[model samples]
Target: MEFLAIILAAGKGSRLKSNLSKPLHEVAGYPLITWVSKAAHAAGASTQICVISPDEQQLYRELSHTMKTVIQVAPKGTGDAVRCCLPHIEKLPKDCPILILYADTPLIQADTLRDLANRIEAGTDICLVGFTADDPTG
Candidate 1:
């Protein structure tokens, strides 16, 4: 089955304290978006789609020439960003799998993604990636 990826980068990231799109921010000497996209690519994604805010069009365009992008006129919730890629998803090969991810988590490893894809291929419907808490809150 073909694999497709959608990277959600439309959030306002109010806590970031700058006008730049959060995905454009550098993490370990590379833009957060780059790492996210590369992970998806390494995960066997045939195409990567990124949803960007209207103001971030130029930034998004300069990143990956082969990437598919959708403009989110308003900063909405994650679900809304997924909706923007619906049309593109619909045209994908039937039974094709689409992986959705955020642009902020640059530490995700390729093996992790491959494991997730393997599970999906083994008939799992949905999987959520998470981290274990080091300590319990009081």
Candidate 2:
């Protein structure tokens, strides 16, 4: 089945209390953005689009050619970030599966994503992934 991945990387990483953007922050040895993108690619997404703020666009320059980029003009919310990628979404086939992922969640595994898509292809109405947080407190 055809698949498209939309990685939300526009967040400012304010919660991390760091100057670096959330997507630019490193997880393990790679940037948070790279981990998510590589996972999406590994999961067999035909195309990947990473929505990021204009200022943080350069953080993903290496993937500019292979991965599509959408710039969020305003720092709205996740809903708005999704809207920023509407054009790219529209270009896809009407029935293509769209996988929405967050860049900051770098711990996600490729196998997990692949299984989600497989479930969808097998006739699930919609698939959602959840992780058990060690600490729920903010």
Clashing pairs in 1: none
Model 2 misplaced regions, further than 4 Å: 60-62
Estimate TM-scores for all models. Answer: 0.86, 0.87
- Best-matching candidate per lDDT: 2
Model 1 ranges off by over 4 Å: 133-138
Q: In model 2, what are the clashing residue pairs, if there are any?
A: none
Q: Please provide, for model 2 over 16-135, each residue's C-alpha lDDT reduced to its tens digit, 9 standing for 90 to 100.
A: 887777787777999888888888888888999888888885566755876888889899998899899899888877767788899878888888888887887777878999977889
The positional error of residue 72 in candidate 2, measured at the CA in angstroms, is: 1.6
lDDT of 2 at 63: 57
Stretch of 10 with least lDDT, candidate 1: 57-66
